[model samples]
Target: MDPVTGSVAPRKILIACIGNIFFGDDGFGVEVARQLMIRRYPSHVQVVDFGIRGMDLAYTLLEDFDELVLVDTVSWGRPPGTLYLIEPDLELIAQAGERGVFLDAHSLDPVKILSFARSLGAAPIHTSLVGCEPESLGSEEDEISVGLSPTVQAMIPAAIAMLDKLVAELSFAKKVEVTSKGAT
Candidate 1:
């Protein structure tokens, strides 16, 4: 509830986890999403495992959400299982294609997806991504059943912890305050 107004202030935040489980460590997002499913959260926060479902996620992004927290694999050339919070510049992403992005059902490209969302005239919203460095992304031609590496698997708790903090900040954080003293 608003402290001053004594009215409820609900901020819609979407925690959309995207990944392909068949591609080894690429499944990190899906796993984190699964673990978060059982936990409780404010009604305003929605957690979804958008594994390999780019179209579903794209359409969902059209909804009016105050913010979006995306969970996915990040290959940053660092050690596997490294977590990082990324606040991407939406403008740069929205410049993807003049013709607009067309998402493949099996493909999961958060950048393109966001671009597509913007292309569809979706309003801009606060967006953040909780990412983990992937150790191995198995190929569909070979051993695609390897699943998440042990290193990445152990970091699920850490990811969840990060998400919790992020959600709290996004859901309940106050606006930045600025004041000026004149004629003092």
Candidate 2:
């Protein structure tokens, strides 16, 4: 906060995109990160693509950021291409250390990463997640399907729109829950 005005400083946001392109629609985050990188965003907003690198992302999470937004493919029994925003319960996540802070070299586990960061004494960050329903993900060891399904690919623009809105709100010190509802 500013000492003179007693006003809070604008929050810095880290948009961490995680995915493995070989897992089909699981590559949503990677693709989204690529698209976001081509556009212009505020200096306070950092967009990163840590595809299948759990440890790299975890260390990045330890940085002092006011807001963290994780973008990935989330399956919540919703129709394919459905975009939803989820504000994770950080307290619950911290307590459920039952999952442990194990990092797999092949996948990105946000929960474990966050827990591990907290265990490392990093301060709690206000985290929000933006996920798209996947149409198909190659989860088989023998399967190496690449790229995103048509449905999930279509939602990239909506995801970018959501982040743009979020960045704007962060500057104003407001919290918002968004859906891909009006996004073209």
Per residue, candidate 2 scores C-alpha lDDT tens digits across 1-184 of 7999998777789999999899899999999999999998878899999888878877887787878889998989989999988877766666645556667787878888877777776667777899999999986877999988888998999998997887787665753332212111
For lDDT, the strongest prediction is 1
Candidate 1 lowest-lDDT run of ten: 175-184
Candidate 1 structure, TM-score to reference: 0.87
Clashing pairs in 1: none
* Global lDDT of each candidate: 0.83, 0.82
Candidate 2 has what TM-score?
0.87
Residues 1-184, model 1: lDDT tens digits: 7789998686789999999898899999999999999999989999999998887887898998878899999998999999999986665565664556777777788878877776776766677899999988985556666579899999999999999999988887553221111111
Instruction: Report the Cα lDDT for residue 168, model 1.
Output: 87
